[model samples]
Target: MASGSKWTYSQNKRFEDVLAEYAEDTPDRWHNVARAVGGGMTAEEAKWRYELLVKDVELIESGRVPFPKYGTPPGEAAAAKAAARTGRRG
Candidate 1:
């Protein structure tokens, strides 16, 4: 709960949940998000975190950042592996 401490996984998840509960136009949204996020997070910190999250989403949506390929299909994975071995683009 120290100032400038990094948010833990649980804290981030809770922040996302609480943020979803409060709309952008909601009164005192950042205050409510901060209180729900707990860990002594202030409204300013919550707003800052929200801004960072928005930027991250924008970057991902713009395709400047590659999306994670967690559930790639088996055939696609095999093809990519073969392409790599043959020094070819998939």
Candidate 2:
């Protein structure tokens, strides 16, 4: 389990610390991930599972998603595409 408060950035740090051990053990589903981490853990907690981290890493490496605001950056991609359609710029 992660150290400190659930919402802290340090939680991510702790998650990273465990990434290697769990790297090859990513679960396909959130429930599986939670179970792997520990049964009775919530799906929300599964967000920190090594699988999600690997997925995020793949997103970065593939350039399928950008790096700001966790990649998509709230409405940014849609807004940019919309601007392009309207013949405008941000």
Candidate 3:
């Protein structure tokens, strides 16, 4: 996480989305994510933020932390809604 500036929910969601699209663990991949994140974030900073979110997501999934109800983080709700509409699992 960037201690220099707090990341809002929307920013974190954007990071998660970009991370998913650029899935591979590579220097270039992090740079791509950073570009998507914008705000002059460097690849190193993006990587740090990503790792923090990954851990939080794992904790949430494992019931160590409550799933955030503030808003759907990224995939979960969107997929569920799409599945409901299509009458198929997302």
Best-matching candidate per lDDT = 1
lDDT by residue for model 1 (1-90), tens: 654677665666688999999999999999998888887889998998889889988988999988745555567889999999999995
Q: Candidate 2 clashing pairs?
A: none
Residue pairs with backbone atoms closer than 3 Å in model 1 (clashes): none
Looking at model 2, how many pairs of residues clash?
Answer: 0
Considering TM-score, where higher is better, how would the candidates rank from best to worst? 1, 3, 2
Ranking by lDDT: 1, 3, 2
Candidate 3 global TM-score: 0.64
**Model 1, residue 30: displacement in angstroms?**
0.6
Better of 1 and 2 by TM-score: 1
Q: lDDT at 60 for candidate 2?
A: 84
lDDT of all predictions: 0.83, 0.60, 0.81
**Cα miss at 12, model 1 (Å)?**
1.4
Q: After superposition, how far is residue 53 of candidate 2 from its true place, in Å?
A: 0.7
Regions of model 2 farther than 4 Å from truth: 1-6, 21-48, 69-90
Kindly list the per-residue Cα lDDT of model 2 for residues 5-67, writing each as its tens digit: 354454455445554445445664545545544535655766555456678889988999887
Error of 3 at 23 (Å): 1.8
